[model samples]
Target: MKPMKLMKEIASDIVSLVYPHICVGCGSVMPFGGGILCAECRADFDEPVLDRCPVCGRIIYHRGKCRSCNGTRLYFDRGHSVFEYKDNVRNAVLNCKYRNMKHIGRYFGEIMADYAEKNALCGFDMVTAVPLHKNRMRQRGYNQSDIPAAMVASRLNTPCVSALERVVDTKPQNFLSREERLKNIKRAFAVRDKEAIKGKSILLIDDIYTTGATVNECAKVLKKNGASRVEFLTFSCRAED
Candidate 1:
């Protein structure tokens, strides 16, 4: 091995020894220093049940489409999520979003990639993330969704496209009611290049799905710009019991 490369590896090992990596899901020091979750935490992460709405990806008793989305005019054709937004999974998501633990996003993205492949959800032409407004991007120093979107696109051998931009800097959606969320997010996103997404099937990526307001707004803009279909893949979702 090159002497410089060996020195760098040694330096990294020294840093790891000094500051051990803690699992984002459980706050335990991972036996293996490279990953974000301990094995037990990964195993215990809550997942949604099989019976879910095909359109909204919400947990439902019966198959096909749930009554909530049956007559609703949703912009996205379908949605899929890896875990229910609760417990350790929820903590991991919060860490990824607000705590600057972006490695967790990559980890979750890999999980989403596996889920998509196993469930045959890899038919989209391109993958794009719900873009963050400039103000939010400046405050956070990164768009959390971009990490997972790029990772998923890389895993699926599809192009990751930044085809949308947040034109309006709206308030955070988590504290808002459904009606408020819909109003706040409407007309907030604009397509970057209509020709890039024209008639293409798009897989939109985001970290969480609360009321589906944010992703739906993004899908609305994408479809308006001639995207043939817009589907969503999220890390965690607010599933109804």
Candidate 2:
């Protein structure tokens, strides 16, 4: 091996010894070259997705179209997701969102970008995140979805645009019934720069996809403001129930 390369590796090893990386999933010290998650945790995050809704990408019972997609109209054309939200996948998401482990977002963002690449889902006019309300943003110190969205744009060679804003501080959607979720998110978001999204095909990024209420509402607002098309991608989603 080149002497300089060997030296650099030694230096990296020394630095790692001094400040080791911690696995976010189990809070264990990470080995050299390990990812944000350890191998076992990665297995958890890699929960297999057998089948999902074409419109919302949630796991479905029988598979033609998910019951949710059939029952309620989705505003976005279609969607893609990376993992089933359960076990360590759920733990990782919660840790990233509430535990200040922002690097987890970057890690998942790379995976999301890879999924887009392998699936031929790139080449969007813009990539954007479902915005947090300014209040929520301040409280949380950041929006968990923002980093992944930005990372995806960087990976896909596109612009990451902040084209929408959460206008209302709505209650958490998981706590609400489907109908209540619809009502809660009504007018919950507003487009920031209509011209930026107008006539553009946009990819909306988020951390999770549950009932589709959040992305559907965001898509509705974007389309209403003149966007040509809108589609969503998420890190994890609810499995078949």
Tens digits of per-residue lDDT, candidate 1, 95-202, equal 878875655666777888887788887778999998999998866657888988988898788999999999999999888987899899989999999999999999
Estimate, for each residue in 158-185, the C-alpha lDDT of model 2 and write its tens digit. 9999999999999888789889999999
- Score each candidate by Cα lDDT: 0.82, 0.83
Instruction: Tell me each candidate's TM-score.
Output: 0.86, 0.87
The runs of at least 3 residues in candidate 1 whose Cα sits more than 4 Å from the true structure, single-residue gaps closed, are: 1-20, 46-48, 62-64
lDDT of 2: 0.83
- RMSD over all Cα atoms, model 1: 5.5
Q: Which has the greatest TM-score? A: 2
The residue pairs that clash in candidate 1, if any, are: none
How many residue-pair clashes does candidate 2 contain? Answer: 0
